[model samples]
Target: MTIAWASFTPWLALSGGVLIGLSATLLWLGMGRIAGISGIAGSLFSLKAASGDRAWRWLFLIGLIAGAFIVHLLTGGLFEVRSGYPIWLLVGGALLVGIGTRMGSGCTSGHGVCGLARLSMRGLVATLTFMGTAFVTVFVIRHLLGFGGSA
Candidate 1:
């Protein structure tokens, strides 16, 4: 309900958004591929994927990890892992996300960024569903369940 004024970084957030958009656009333009991380990663090791396809997927995944590492190093550990949440909870959440992505036929990056950019109706519906679910979940956790604190 309230903003975390101390942690607010609008400029950084805007910059990050721009970078994501730029990278997605570039990937589309250059390779004629959608920058759907989940799809790319999910098919990376599949027998259906060609050897050349696997190489790009590996590079993309590696670039994601490397980018985060580079930022962490540059900021001297600006990002810190939050404690308090149990490992099982985190793992469960990840598994649920993976399942959800599979069930939905694509992840947020695929449906939201690429699909929406192409003016696809499916993308709009998927994005709305994703956002609506997220809002409800946060509301339940913070207000009804009294789990997460106002951050």
Candidate 2:
């Protein structure tokens, strides 16, 4: 394998990581909530949740999407994540993720970030399980099934 030095950016990557960590920390510290996309999305329609909280969550989610759009516009080039799948399939997959997040009680951000940071045993188990499953899926797709359609 060959690495392109011009495209390699350790400092920028580190800065992005630091920004994400800081954002998660601030969210948790200020809101007393885990910075989990799944939970935040779910809370939008949660009648039991306070409307004021939901309003903030909605704005945050919108800003996340808007930020990505803005970056795509400002940057000349961005990662072209090609998925050789139909829009319907993508929508279906997203719905499945939503359901899974609800059933799991928390998504990766919640478990991987807040849970693990707090040294919760369940978080460790969940994170390991998620990682293991992801590894197995990739292996199966790339090697066993030879599904090189797209990533």
Candidate 3:
């Protein structure tokens, strides 16, 4: 187990975590809503919701995309933006994530961050399952299957 110390930026990681936490906190306090990306996105398609409900979701998604662009501009091509995965794998992974988020009733931002902060048992269980599954998947793929160096 070796740390990639050359690429490690603890300060940046901490600041990003703090920013996410703060934004989640603010969203909760201001709107009495959890800042779960999947929930917010899924709700946009709800026929039961009021017409006015979709605006915030759209804005939130737009802001997320725009923020990535902003970061790219600020970093000035220093970042490695591409994942080395094949397109089919990326698409499959995305579909799986969408399905998982739907089945779990929340994504990582929702369950791991907001739900845990609110002390919900569902959040704890979901987060544990997510982390455990990720650990097992990585172990199987990298150690057992010997695909570690490919990606």
Candidate 4:
């Protein structure tokens, strides 16, 4: 198997991972809540949460969007990512993720990061399933279907 050496950015990826982990840790330490995007987004629709809970949830959600904006500003431009899929396909995939997040108890950041760190058995299973599924998906799309990009 050949490696995509030109596309590899291990340093950048590791730095991003560190930043995410640190933010999650700080959120947990300061607010006693998991920094799970799905939960934060879903909590916005809850009308009966306690005042403090609602406030922090909203803050977290806003912070998430704002953080990305700030990063774009610092970087002087938005990064361009080349995905071969059309907008409709991207939206469809996002909708499917919403459903999966609802069914699976949390999204990747929630289960794969925070939950796994806490040593939850469910988190272990979810992470393994997700990683395995992702590997199979790339293999099928690239090798079997032969639709992967040139780069």
Instruction: For each of the candidates, give the backbone clash count.
Output: 0, 0, 0, 0
- Runs of candidate 3 with Cα error greater than 4 angstroms are 45-48, 148-151
Model 1 agreement with the true structure over 64-109: per-residue lDDT tens digits:
9999899888989866677777576578778988888877877889
Q: Estimate each model's TM-score.
A: 0.88, 0.79, 0.87, 0.82
Task: Judge candidate 4 at residue 108 and give its lDDT.
Answer: 83
RMSD for each of the candidates: 2.0, 3.1, 2.1, 2.5
All candidates in order of TM-score, best leading: 1, 3, 4, 2
lDDT of 2 by residue, 27-47 (tens): 889878778887888878667
Error of 3 at 132 (Å): 0.8
Please, what's the RMSD in Å of model 4? Answer: 2.5
Report residue 1 deviation for candidate 4 (angstroms). 2.8
